[model samples]
Target: MGKRDREILKNICIESVAAEGNALAHVNGKTLFVPLCVPGDIVNVQVTHKKKNYMEGYMLELVTPSPMRLAPFCSHFGDCGGCRWQPIPYDKQLEFKQQQVVDQLTRIGKLDLPVIAPIMASENTVRYRNKLEFTFSNSRWVPFEALRQEAGAREVPPSPAPKAGHQSAPESAPLPVSGSAPATQLPALGFHVRGRFDKVLDIETCHLQEEPSNAIRLAVRDYAIDKGLSFFDLRQQTGFLRTLMIRITLTGEVMVVVVFAHDNPEAGEDDAARKALLDYLQHTFPQITSLHYIINTKRNDSLGDQEVIHYAGKPYIVETMEDLEFRIGPKSFYQ
Candidate 1:
C-alpha cells in the first residue's frame, strides 16, 4: 500500500460520524477520517496523513455549518471525548448515527437487508449511560484544543495541597498515605481520551445517562480516592483497582461492580475491604440494590474470564427493555 504525507486544506463535506468518532468523507476518491466533525458539516480539513485507500485529517475551519448543529450542553463537550455528537443536536445525532449504521451495513456488510429504519431515540439523552469506566495514570491531563481555547482567558490553577504527611497540621499524619496522591479528583467521568486510554478528560456533567448515575460515579470515585484505592492499568495489567462499572435499571435500581487486577488486603484479608465497600454503598447510596467485586487475573481485555467472587446483593441486575428483561452480570455488555 502506498502512503503519502501532505497538508492539503480542502472543503470536505462530512457524510457522517462513525461509531468510533471518526467523521467519514470521500476526498478525491479516497476515504478520509476527520476528527471533530459531524454529518452535513462543510469543513476545511487539513490532510495530515494519506494512504492508498484513505486519508486522515484534522478540522481546520468550519467553512459551511450544518443546520443540525447546536450548542452542546456539556462544557467539556469536545474535551471529554465521551459523546462526539454533542455538538450536533441530540435528535439529529441519533438520526445520523442510525443512517451511518445503515450505510455501513449496505456498503460494507453487503447484506441485502431490508431498508434501514430509524433508531428508537433514547428516552433520556442526558444520564442515559448506565456504565462508565475511568482510567488512572501518572500523566498530565490535556483537554481538547477547542475547549482550551474557549477557556483561554479563564484558567483555574490546581488546588492547594494540605502539605505532605500532614493531614490537619497539628493533628493527623496526612491520613496514612497509601497509593499515589489519593487519585486527585477522579479523572473526568465522561469518556476515554481519543486514542489514549490512560488519559481521561474530566466531565462535569453528561447528558447521556441518568443524573444520579453521574453523581454516583463522581461520589464513588471521591470515596475511593479518599480511601486511597488505586486505579488499574490496562497496558501493564497492574494496579489495585482496574475499573469501576455501574449498572442501573429503569426501576431506579443501581448496581456497582468494582473490578480489581488482583485481590487487595482488605478483600483478601478476611474480605474486610470488600465488606466495607458494600456497607458504604448500602448505607450511603440506598438506591444501590446490588454490588459486586470482579477479580480479573488474565492479562488480556476479555473480561468474560473475570469472575464475580463476592456480592452484596443479587448476582445480576435486571434491566427491562421492550418488555424483555435482560439479566446483566458483572461481565455483561451494555447493549
Candidate 2:
C-alpha cells in the first residue's frame, strides 16, 4: 500500500490485554491489537495488518502512558523474546492471565464453570524461574537506540601510551567508533531477538534467574572470547559454542549444561578447549552441584536424542517437595 493510503489511528485508549499479551482496543465494531502497550494507555498506531474481525498495528506514539504500567526491569524488554508483559504490574498480570484462562474455558471450550477465584500470584516477580537456556551467536544484535545515542554522545580523547616499565591493561571488546559499525565482532551469549533467529542480544544481566547465573554466563562468554573459541553462526551452522542451559532447584542446587557444535567433520573436536572451559567453571563456581556438556553435531538445538556427558559433581540435581525428592537430569522436563 502507498504511504498516504495507510491507516493511522489517533489517541485510542487501550481497553484490555488480549491473547498473546497484545494491548486490545475497539475501533468502531472491529478489534484492534497494539504491541508494547498496556490497558488505559492512549496511543497513536499505524495499522499494519487488517482483517474482517480484527486489526494489528505498531504503536506510532504513546500519546499518554498508562497508570497501570510499571517500569520494566530488563534492559532487553522489548527486543528480547524471553519475556513479555513486563510493563503491567504483577497483580494486574495475574488478573489478565486469570481472565484469559476463564475466557478460554468458557468461550473456546464452551464449558459451564463456577465462580473462579483470583489466580495465585508469585511472591517474587523477578528471578523466580527455575531454568534458562541461552544461545551463542557470532552476529550480536545492536539496538538502534544504542547506535543513535552513541552518534549523539560527545567524543573523548584516547589514552596515552604507557611507560616502558609498566605493562598495559588487557584489551576489552571494541565499541562502535563512529556509531556506524557495532562494537567488536565479539560473539554474544544470550537470548535471540524477537523474530530474528540469526540475531542474539548480548545480555549484561537478566532478572529471570538469580545470582551466579548471570556471572557464570558472562564469565564463560569472556573466557571463550579470550581463548579464541568460535561462536555458532545460525545461518552458516558452524562454531564451537552453540548453547548453554542453567537449571536451579529450590533446594539450592545448581545445574549447568553447555552444548558444543562440531559441524565440520574434518576439523574434528577441540577437546582441549572444551575441557578448559568446563574446568574454569568447575573451579570458579564450586556451588554448581551438577555440570554437564553435550556434543551437538546437528543443525538444530534439540538435545533430546543427543548424549549428555557428565563432567563434574553429580549427573543430576535434586529438587525436593515435602518428603519426595526428584532428580532432574540434563534433558528432564520440569515446570
lDDT of 1: 0.63
Per-residue lDDT value at 288 in model 1: 75
Write one digit per residue (lDDT tens) for candidate 1, span 1-335.
12133454556789877657778889779888986676788876656677899888667567777777776677655555566667677787777778777778888999788766678876667766676665443222454342234355555343235334322212211111111122233333335656666565545566665646777767766666677665655456665655667777776777787766666565465256556766777778777778887777677545776667646777777888887888877777866
What are the TM-scores, per candidate, against the unseen true structure? 0.72, 0.86
Residue-level lDDT tens digits of model 2 in 1-335: 44434576778999998877688999979999987788999977777678899988767667788998787788788777766799898888898899889999999999999998888777888888889999999877776555545555633344435344422222321121211134466578999876677788889999998878999999999999998999999999988899999999988899999999973545544887888899999999999999999999898999999999999999999998789999999999986
Worst 10 residues of 2 by lDDT: 171-180
- Listed per model in order, the count of residue pairs whose N, CA or C atoms clash below 3 Å is 15, 0
Q: After superposition, how far is residue 280 of candidate 2 from its true place, in Å?
A: 1.1
Root-mean-square deviation of Cα positions for candidate 1 versus the true structure, in angstroms:
10.8
Report how far residue 113 has shifted in candidate 2, in Å. Answer: 1.5
